[model samples]
Target: MEMLSGAEMVVRALQDEGVEYIFGYPGGAVLHIYDALFQQDTVNHILVRHEQAATHAADGYARSTGKPGVVLVTSGPGATNAITGIATAFMDSIPMVVLSGQVRSDWIGDDAFQETDMVGLSRPIVKHSFMVRDPRQIPEMIKKAFYIANTGRPGPVLVDIPKDHTAPHNTFPYEYPKKVKMRSYAPVTRGHSGQIRKAVDELLKAKRPVLYAGGGVVQGEASQALTALARKLNFPVTNTLMGLGAYPGSDEQFLGMLGMHGTYEANMAMHNADVILVAGARLDDRVTNDARKFCPGAKIIHIDIDPASISKNVAAHIPIVGPVKQVLEEMLTMLDEQGEVGTDTKSLERWWQEIAGWRKVHGLRYETNEQGPMKPQQVVQALYKATKGEAYVTSDVGQHQMFAAQHYLYDRPRQWINSGGLGTMGFGLPAAMGVQFAHPDAVVACVTGEGSIQMNIQELSTCLQYGLPIKIININNQALGMVRQWQDMQYGGRHSQSYMESLPDFVKLAESYGHVGMLVEKLEDLDGAMEEAFALKDRLVFMDIYVDPTEHVYPMHIADGSMRDMWLSKTERT
Candidate 1:
């Protein structure tokens, strides 16, 4: 065994974990750790302008690569600033390990400078929180952090390390744990055969069935199994916001997203389905709207790795707790042995006709003028066409996020990333940077709005410094579009502080950061601008596209409203 400082142990442990990049910002409390990190050559460090952006960048890296993203930050405000990012990752079930510095062990509870209760503050949002009391426990804690963060129902894990642990005199031999064993944390990876048989029996017996999938399927890497199951049964599939790319959006069986801003046909199908097969999706309020009235005619079958999520929100007739991929594989094998007891062909045709009627009546529609300011929908459509639906898309929370969700079609898991559970603003830019870092050869784009882009706009410097070719599409409406829409619909259009009185010129802002910037005001120039942005292979591009200020997202289901109570557009009421 070799002697090493606590800081050296931390760096060595990270190297053992195969950590390639660490997104973070340093401070006085973490100076020793930072120095250790500087001496390391295997791990690359990205210094983000804000601690929040650092977490987001790590989250993006995790989402895109299906690995536990690592973050390092100082104590006090640095740790606090990262809360939003941590909460966002937790809500979305993204795997992340956040390492924050703490005051010296001797100064504990003495109101030390930059000292805050990191464990208490983060307990609510993190899957688990730990404060390192002994320097020897650092290696073990690091191992546990990664294990917990990437295991069943993956989420962010926080570890607070005291400054004293990194003292020069403090020494411990470094050795990475060969395995992690948590007595109470073993996750069930296989579904019970009896329950799988029961679910398959129900699916074969039902005539009008729907598969509602969520991000859990993506997290489990079960898209292939999910696709096989859907195709074999010839069932229509609808995804939640987080589940967009679980099923190919171009497939005829795909019914688009199914929630508050879901497609008309998707919502209608859910309301009318006789059997609802839920795969890796939680029945959140946004999807259910009214729990009592949701899918009144359906018998629900929920499959998830976490047993607590089985029937917590909505009653599940058949609840199967296991990994999505394994469960789906088992179900498919059982169905094959049973000789494919498919649903009635005539009944399915009739159901399809009915769903087709709804699609024709309430399809996604938007108005645009070729000579006027570009519509947000038009810009998104243009981007989709320009990129050929191959770019990794991230979005900041607002109407622009909804528009991106609606217009862009994702055909694979991890292609589309957004703040679904937390709806955090300013998630786009940093997330895009993370995605770009994960897939340096692939195109990455961040679709943001005027209001949300300013939250972490300083990250543009990070992009420029790293030479990351991330495309930033700002839908400039000069207002908090989503809030304004709500105010217009629910608050008598008072507008409040939603409007941006002195919005900075995005093109000029991009130029200041030494990046290419383009402005598109007219609809006719959108395609050309998008083409130009896509052609730039080396430099970052910022496209500030002007859109209709008064425009609102359609097919909106307000709180406490049923799927049938959707508002089609501004001119149409429920």
Candidate 2:
């Protein structure tokens, strides 16, 4: 046994868990932990401007790498600032462990300086939260936090360490736990044989079949399994906004993303599907506008690790509760046993033809003027071309997020990272920082709107300090793009306060932060600007692209209408 202070135990435990990077912002209450971090070199700490960015950065790291992201912060405001990012992770089910310093145990009720009830504040969002009651329990608690964050349906887990818990005097013999077990928590990893059989039977009988995938496919690392199953059955695959790249976008079987901002072909396929196989996707409002109208005639075979998510939104006719990768693998094995007896070939052919007809709607089409203001969609398309579809793309929530999802045809999982469930605007830039850190040699880009970029713009300093050469693609609509789009459609064209009245000079702002900045107001200058930016391989580059302010994301669905009802372009907004 090795004698160590509580702070030392924290560092040792993280290293044992194979943690290589941590995102954090230091404060008074967490100085001891910071000091412990300083004495170590295995775990690198990324200093962020705000506590919120730390969590978002950690989230990006987790989503991109399929590992639990770690975060360290001070008590009170530090913990509270991280709440939004934690909630964002919770909604998306990202694996993360948040370590926050707290007030001393004796001063907890006294409301001492920098004291805040972090456990209480974070209870609703985290998968589990713990307040360290004993200094010796640090190793065990840290292990449990990581276990909870990464197992079952992966999510953020918080562990609040009172400053006294890590005091220099509280020394003890420490050994990091090799394994963690909780009698109360055991997630089923294999699907019920009977349920999988039933699902296979239903699939063989499907006339109009669709394979709908969500973040779970990416989280479960089952993209290959999903692709194999879809090809075996010849079913059209449609992914959710967060589920992009689960199937190759260029594949003829892929029907594009399916949801509120999804493709017209994908939504139509969902509405008319006879057998819908939903893998790791919650049928949230964005995907299913009204539960009553979603896949009305479909016999849904839902595969999920979380049983609560199966029927919580849309009722599952044949539910297989288990790990998506395992279940999908099992399903493939069963199909393999059947040889060529699996799908109704004639029916699948008819389904594919119907999908092709729907695809002709061309919902993603956007205008590109050689000399006029740029269309935001073209920026994303150009990004895809410049990167040759190899860059790791992250996005902030808004019209640009939708455009990126629609235009940037991803061919692999974990490449398209964004705030999907919580729709957090400030997620993109900080997330790109984490993505860049994870793959230092890979090209990473943050696709964000003007409003979203400013939310965590201060992280520019962190980028400079770390030498993270991420490309920041700012689609400057000079207004809250999404808000204006909604107002224009639902509020009788009332712009209201959606437009930005006072905006900072983004070009100078980037230059001031010790990075290269380029402004592209016309289509001709766009390609040249992007080329120059990527050519600077050692420095971060910010491209401020001014686009038409009145443009709205189209293929817009009718309010309170089923997936079948969609307005292909602005001509049908009314």
lDDT of 1 by residue, 180-283 (tens): 99998898879988998899989988889999999999999999999999999888999999999999988899999998999989988998899999999999
* Superposed model 2: Cα runs more than 4 Å off: 369-371
Clashes found in each candidate (C-alpha, N, C closer than 3 A): 0, 0
What are the Cα lDDT values of the candidates? 0.92, 0.91
**Poorly placed runs, candidate 1 (over 4 Å):** none
lDDT of 2 by residue, 350-405 (tens): 88888888888788776666766789998998898889998899999999999999
> TM-scores across all candidates?
0.98, 0.99
Clashes of 1: 0
**Candidate 1, residue 94: how far the Cα is off, in Å:** 0.6
Q: What are the C-alpha RMSDs, in order, of all predicted structures?
A: 1.1, 1.1
Q: Model 1, residue 78: displacement in angstroms?
A: 1.0
